[model samples]
Target: MTDISLEETIRSFNNTGYPFPEDKTIHSLFEEQVERTPHHIAAMFRGASLTYRELNEKANSLAYLLREKGVRPDVIVGILLERSLEMIVGIFAILKAGGAYLPISPAYPVQRVQHLLRESAAPILLTQTQLISRFSIDPDEAEVIPIDLNGPVYTYPTLNLQPVNSPHDLVYVIYTSGSTGKPKGVGVEHYSLVNRLNWMQRKYPISLTDTILQKTPYFFDVSVWEMFWWSIVGARVSFLIPGGERFPQAIIETVQTHSVTVMHFVPSMMSVFLEYLRNSQSDIQRMSTLRQVFASGEKLTVANVRAFYDVLFIQNKTQLANLYGPTEATVDVTYYDCPMDDSLLHTIDKIPIGKPIDNTQMYILGENGELLPVGETGELYIGGVGVARGYLNNPQLTSERFILFNPQGLFLQKPPLDPAKTPDNNPPLTESFKGVQGGVFQKAHLLYKTGDLARWLDNGNIEYLGRQDFQVKIHGLRIELGEIESVLSRHPLVRDCAVIVKQFSQNITLIVGYIVPKAENVSSGELKEYLKNLLPEYMVPNMFVIMENFPLTPSGKVDRNALPDPSGLFGTKK
Candidate 1:
């Protein structure tokens, strides 16, 4: 935007309204699907399965009890359970009772669990009796309600109780990784979650026969869509056993046995799965039944894109989509479809996380809230029906992340809403952004500052460049770890890789590359020589550490914090 005149660049989004169901609740849409396919198998875990009618009735029975316990709109109910039929039932029951369900993993440390519970201030916890020992719960903390403990639940009437909940009420408050403290609770409203799910259904519509594998843990936001996306479309859900999400062989067998059509992955785990496909012929053939493979949570590498075609995608029409978003802006806001042709991949080495979802507005803005031009890297800001209300119980932190801004390109267009009719206490626009004529926005609208660095491509797609906070400054040179990792992942011998900065001495910081070799290990000198030809000398890692595997989080993301110390490792320092 370097002092460029606003009149020169084309101003888009002049008309940004869609025919989305503005008033429908998530369960309301699911009810419609239930009417369409009541006899269809709605969920499957192990040998047990539930039809649409049976699931709704069971959820309604539990919902009756939740409402009796004073569950209402915006009420957070703690849910801790392993992957089972009851887990899905509890989620629906909480939502049907007009309460926002908060997921707590059974594998979480007791201290972290206590912290989340304390921060959330939940009054009720849904869990199994056997798992009650896992939580170090104080008597006054939360009233534990095990699904099986209530023997009369099946005898209770199975009817959809009319809840006093509106679309603006909170449906789920998911926790995400945060700095300065423990994980932050991102409270997403029913409207935001419904819009993302509806838009996804429209773009990539799932059929009644399609089976979506629910492998992602409920703690992460990606599981939000994985759980509900199919429920609305009347698609069957095949639940993966607890902790089996990281195993590629297990995924293949699940897909083959259940005829799973749709699934998702974080790019790190996707890379691992694709390599496993290449090594085994039976696994690759079994994975051929997949209709779609979704990648998100981290940057999708070019190598991962190419490997999809070489193995799993060669025999089938399974489309691979890349999704990008944070917990604050719902599960996902931007999506990309990987092209199948080699000629298409030749022109673009980096695949773009293509355009905003329906009725959503995405802007790449520079410092001071001014809009950055194409090809210039800047912070990504999301504004639309998809943006969440704000962080729960953290006003100062929420205000810092969610902001009001008037982009240079959109300043001339009509505001999303009326300025005089608004009633919020947020400050009225008083200042103008630089290099714009009257860049003040009279109307107050909230936008989530993702803190993610991205740039707009020539085709109106966005190229995600990692997190702004994750960028490391070494010797006055700011470096993007994703760029280094992307280049390192391109090497022929590397199976999977990650680049992290380690501080050893007061003045000495080293860039460390941790890699899982394909078959045989390669020496550090050879890897350094390969990186030298592709990357700048400063961007190359100071040391390369070969490893058997990269440790992953419960949600299947590479846990960089758990990487072992690189001291005394085999490598050369520049």
Candidate 2:
């Protein structure tokens, strides 16, 4: 670890270049847009468009109904519905009512949905008439409001209602995959969401003329921006019809028909879509209206970048950018716009995840919590305004992940809290501020420890290596699976690949490679030789399995857990 002073470390990590509004909430920002352009189309779904005025009225009606059922600030309301107009209404209503919305996808297993509902301890659940029957919950446990059936019956004022939420109040709780079997809910506050939107407006401003495609599920954190960010800037948000999320043709047609100016995709889905365009010889000219494409949720490979440049950017002036952030950070913390140069893309092994966004700070820290110097790999710790309020209903895990560090001297004067304004049954806010390096000032800000491993580059960009736990030990030599996968991805015949450690017995373990070949009749022998020439003998996978396609998680990420075990055919390592 570098022997940098505490004050120096604070200066190094703080990204104060871009400014963000501290007093605004997501609801307040959207209301301003609604007031500015109430007649403008806010969102479109299946040939039907909802104007800002209509959307606000629908949300206001539901918000009034929710308030009648005792929903208020910090309260978690469950929202179980598919992608539709009602889904968007449910989200806005929850925020307007000053309650955090807990999104549960109706497609999720009954048990998983029930677990999330119970875990959130939501007082009310908003769903459509069809999904209301899918959930098996007692009436006394939580109030179920069917938006399609019962919402229109109740007459509530559709006029603009002032949101009764503080900046620090909870806005939403999104659950992410946990190391353990259960998913952990991350509670994001209005301040963080507002900061993110404000930064986006300054960096990549969207206008009413721009139409953003909303394909991501509501349960995912990215959907937060997809649903509300456009509304803040008076832009139109176009939704993908049900069953069209994974279909490339459907996505392309929607973009062409709706003239979508902005869209986002995970690298895995982007690769598939690019391949569809290449193979089908689709009319890429139709998508000339697209202005930007954002890739995140997984590592964006160089090949995928090249594919976008050659297939998409070459024909049109669409900007392809790589965004990096976990669910803990409100959507994205950093972004890198890919330059249209093949030689430059070929030279670099991985695209940089870029510098911190407005008001967000990124620090590469060693295992012992010491900040590492540039060019050295360490655990990535995120600090600043985007840090969430911590995990919901899991204080122990929250404390373990969210650390306290006050680099700035803002906490010197403590502010008074109003007991009546605070949530009645919510967990008490805990103060765990320890002085920085035993300094006189004892104030500390919360920083989230992202278990991801990364290194600061000479150009000030951060190169994400992989997860710390993703490192696997084989034959007494620890190996980073990402390093091997990165090398394999460069192979001309390999379209996509993933590396995993398979255990056949207590004493026998083997590193296996799963590959999606680009050409027919490609054998494991060719790939083995290709890897051996570039990697050490031990680094090479013990076996290679050619896969037609890798299974994907609900979030469109490569699902390692769903990978089939090859132990049955390959017995053990020779």
Candidate 3:
């Protein structure tokens, strides 16, 4: 079917990764930027602004207060806040205090928030006064600190705190939906973030005058680079008001007002944003200042690429880079800078998720663990410095997903690490993150088995197909169907349920919940409201199907293929 061989594909896709200084912390690098440009505006929200010096001093004040509260390296401190100056201040404060800040969005359901707090073993939580009352916090379980830093915070010294976190120490823990019907925390260490940030800075060099629009929610790992990237190079970051990301006009206005040069969008949102611009004549002209637009979280489709060019790229010299990776692999691993030329549409059909960034390796492996040749679809295994420490407090799940690959044979049958060789007492936290440096782990590298299907194209770029499992990406959210089904089945009137994604033409993807009710009747409205209390709004099915009985296969498994197509039968959210 294809001319390219296995050897050529492997050599082309995998980058010659270099070693990064493994002993550095994320904040230490940020501190250097502060000394260089202390008075430059670091972040802007609404009309309020903070210079590098002011932001640093405020973060330092909170850091001192947090340190006194026993926050230290590897300690998980919860931060639940709406988008504001305090939200930015709180994130830096947690890092400066030598703690991994777990980003908990204010939009999260109370039950979901409670689960994260409990599962993470969080000791201290930082939140605004408006958000603190939403959660019923136990003093013994976790101490809650309302993030109003005016009263006593200013009394503490504004000097930078001495570094304590090691390269191995976790900088953040992002909770993603788990296939096992629960949310699992993925702890990313400092070195991994440093590698990701370094690659971003070098590959896409933005000037000090360039302003980056920070709109993605902090709960997602995409926001990690958005929050910290500008600080390193002294670039300005423009933050949107809470929930402002949903408004296209606001985003365009912000870009035009700030001259925002860099920003990111989920592929679905890109379509929505482009669609908005297509309909609006004036708004499209206002978005001319955008330099590099990033597309991630979902598949970068042909339509998305076309929409980008039709809306802005053709008129302005804006570049749309399709970035691909899982949250497990620090934000993004591969990037394809879309050809700025107008002729790209006629020549190229689907955009390829480009080659691995610096210090990263992408391998396409067959079912039997053989190296997949060019054009052959296989599971994508990512390795290198960007790989995070496995899920926090989830050894079994960590062992299942993160494994050492054997290029010679089948994958290592057992867990990647030996108990005796593990330096950390916690086995899950001891993944060989630094092993991939300079390809030392050619025999066995610590790689995250991204369940997404992909293949190596002729010229070295990787083409993402779709998920190999139950996980689906909707509006840039990586959702586990099992997690949704688990929550749906828990309803008092629901007997059993199956969650699936329904896709039609023009990228109309919707979450569909097929339920067999326990009671005589359970209204769709009732089910929706109940699920909204337990799961995030996006996880809730856009439509509900009341099935008398689910069609099953010979083995008594729910035959998803036999499930009715609800396209015309029901109208629901897109």
Superposed by TM-score, candidate 1 places the C-alpha of residue 512 at a distance from the truth, in angstroms, of: 10
* Residues 138-193 of candidate 3: C-alpha lDDT, one tens digit per residue: 88888988876554455678999988888778899999998777898999988888
Question: For this target, which candidate reaches the highest lDDT against the unseen true structure?
Answer: 3
Off by over 4 Å in 1: 1-16, 149-153, 407-444, 471-574
Which residue runs does candidate 2 get wrong by more than 4 Å?
1-13, 149-154, 280-282, 406-444, 470-574
Give Cα distance to truth, residue 318, candidate 2, Å: 0.9
> Would you estimate the TM-scores of all the predictions?
0.77, 0.77, 0.91
Clash pairs, candidate 2, are 405-445
Candidate 2 per-residue lDDT over residues 116-167, each given as its tens digit:
7778889888888887777787777787888872355337898767668887
Q: Choose 2 or 3, whichever is better by TM-score.
A: 3
True-structure RMSD, every candidate:
11.8, 12.0, 6.0
- lDDT, candidate 1, at 409: 42
Instruction: State residue 555's C-alpha deviation in candidate 1, in Å.
Output: 38
lDDT of 2: 0.78
Using TM-score as the yardstick, the better of models 1 and 3 is: 3
Return model 3's CA RMSD, one decimal.
6.0
